[model samples]
Target chain A: MSDEVVTPLSHEECWQMLREEEFGRLAFRLVDEVHITPVNYAVDHDTLLFRTAAGNKLLSVAMGAEVAFEIDRYDDHHARSVVVRGGARILHEDEEHRADNVPLRPWVGTPKYNVVEITPRVVTGRAFRLTRPWLHLTLDGLGQE
Target chain B: MSDEVVTPLSHEECWQMLREEEFGRLAFRLVDEVHITPVNYAVDHDTLLFRTAAGNKLLSVAMGAEVAFEIDRYDDHHARSVVVRGGARILHEDEEHRADNVPLRPWVGTPKYNVVEITPRVVTGRAFRLTRPWLHLTLDGLGQE
Candidate 1:
């Protein structure tokens, strides 16, 4: 792995970075709108799971239909992402994540909450570093020195 | 302030509940795609202020773009929300919340972070007691009531 400033992180590197993250953002679209929510999640193979209070964040993503989850990480000029394109159906009430062990901070002074589990079938990612807008490229070298 | 089975909390009550929260989700759109991040924030009057490690979030939303921030509280069957849809811009780097006195467990895990402030032009909310698909809503309701 070289310290080259112009190299892009590989597809596998992108997925690895995303998986290394214990938390991620949940993205969803509805009509002309899209919503993203922050969640404490664990990547179980190819699925994404997080706990929410059940109303806005969880139900809003329901979107009266399907939704998407996007988890990404970036440092200054380098960004790598992995997206899970799949329809999300709210999980059965708080059995998974055990509800009691979720490391979530209460944003509404509430003591308890529910959980949502998403199984993603289509997982894809992209990685690149920008030396400002005038110079941007994908590190196709796979970070090999 | 009726303790009826479906009593709705007023805006004041909701804001008070939200004030106790120091974390929230910031959602935005870039290239027709939605992205979200969780931040530890402080409520300044009506706006949401937090810090970021700098990336697409700052690029997309802070460059005079629209975004959304949501916070909610939920119990076994009752929930309430407060969402702000407006513009997010970079706040002064020396804001009060930047104090070293604050303790935060940030995923970015670095001190080179920047402060972001989200000023919501539209603040909307609704409360409900949901049992399965049947949603019992209160004031500002937008779903099945």
Candidate 2:
């Protein structure tokens, strides 16, 4: 058996994963504290687009703080995660119209009028095989059964 | 039907959800940038515990940075998210023994010697109904047949 359990994902694979998944967690700095919130996002070209209400997320973008967005999926045997670190900014006027072209929508019924974009500076990901120590052994799988 | 679609989770409920889940994203600051990474964790009393190799996550704990950890689950109809904000620190010497009592384990085959604890200052959560615009209507539901 191969001893390698973790492998690095390529840039193309990272973007493909981002494009396929609509939900992810967004991490941003608000003053000295770091906050992570789940968000629904869409991949637009090389940037990520999402809508938000007027709150700390918008405030953080206004303050020009760096943000990290992550998405992952795991089954019983394997897992993959992609992280994007970048500067977030709120879209305005014509940019808001551009955002409308994407399929992004608020998950809740609340009105989230502010559209934000994340321009990634660093994108990295990893795929790893999980070790299931609790897997049950079955006699049927053996020749004795 | 009532128009209320989003509801806040009680403190007890938040803790219950945290206790039930073993995987979540941990967000912390390194310098001015915020980073998010998925981790497998276990709830130990009022704190959260997980093991990691020597890396940026451990470095953030050593620097006494406030971290945000989040876990969420969503289906086609509903979604629930819980966020925990706390200060993370590395467990040393005998403290590592306490972590061993928990079910926490590294997902990969590599060895993770350092155990870290997150002492939460604020824990909050919300449950919301999802608006699935893509749901197809069936005549059977209307009793047309």
Candidate 3:
């Protein structure tokens, strides 16, 4: 049997997955290092919107750094992942009013007044079938006896 | 009731979560931009180990770039996240032999001959209670009648 179980996801499928999931990890460059944090987001008109407090995440967007956002789901049989690479910008003045309708909510009680939008430059994803090595070993041993 | 529901996880709790989860996202800098990809990993000693092919991830390790690895879990009521920030190095020669005992296998069928280890400089995490805004709004509307 061929061992290659990975399948590439199409553009439409990628956007659909992004719409279905509300939580994801946001990765951004901070000087010489990279940082990743989990954020709850909403997909709106081909863009991703998330709210954050005034922190390093907000600082990175203020600096206009390119960021990557990813979401994935997996079970015992299969796994899928989607990644969006884009430029992040904080909403300002009139734009902030537009974001008010996106239905985004922060999980914590802390005030997250900063609403950031990620305009994706490239979106990519893959799906792969999972293999349980220890389970396979046990089955193989049983068959050998 | 206070809206703030996030609680900081102890260092011990962070490592415990890391040991329990098999998959996480690895974020690293590639030139001017940052990238994040899902990976299956193993917790060996105080470090994290994963296998990868000769790709951007391996190249980043060769460049001695600092990276971030994150794993999280959430349910209807709560969410927990852990992030590890540190330098990644590709295990070589004798070190590769040591990594052979880590029990990490690739989800894909492709050959992944390179083994990389992340020695973390800082490990931080948080646990937060989730709020379902739509559900709460629906209940509030029902009571308004």
The digit string of per-residue lDDT tens for model 3 on A1-145 reads 2355888889999998887777899998877878899998888898999878766444554357899999998865678899999989887857876566766677666765677889999999988887756434332321100
Alpha-carbon shift of residue A93 in model 1 (angstroms):
24
lDDT of 2 by residue, A29-131 (tens): 8878888889888889999998777675445443467899999888667888999999888877678876766667777888656778999999999988887
Candidate of highest TM-score: 2
Residue-pair clash count for candidate 2 = 0
What is the Å distance of residue A13 in model 3 from its true position?
0.4
Q: For each candidate, what is the lDDT?
A: 0.53, 0.79, 0.79
For all the candidates, what are their Cα RMSDs to the real structure?
A: 14.2, 7.1, 6.9
Candidate 3: lDDT of A25? 97
Tens-digit lDDT string for candidate 1 (A1-145): 3454334456576556555654455666554455554455655555555656657554644633545565554444555556665556656654554433433333233344565667665666654342322122222211111
lDDT for residue B5 in candidate 2, whole number 0-100: 79
Give the per-residue lDDT digits (tens) of candidate 1, residues B13-121: 6566555655456666665455554455666676666666656444544346777776654444555656667787775656745433333223333446666667767
> What are the per-residue Cα lDDT tens digits for candidate 3 across B78-136?
88899999988887757876566765677666765677899999999988887756544
lDDT of 2 by residue, B1-145 (tens): 2457788889999998887777899998887778788998889999999877766444544357789999987866778899999889988778888777776778787865677899999999988887756334322211100
Categorize the docking of model 3.
acceptable
Give residue A82's lDDT in candidate 1 (0 to 100).
Answer: 63
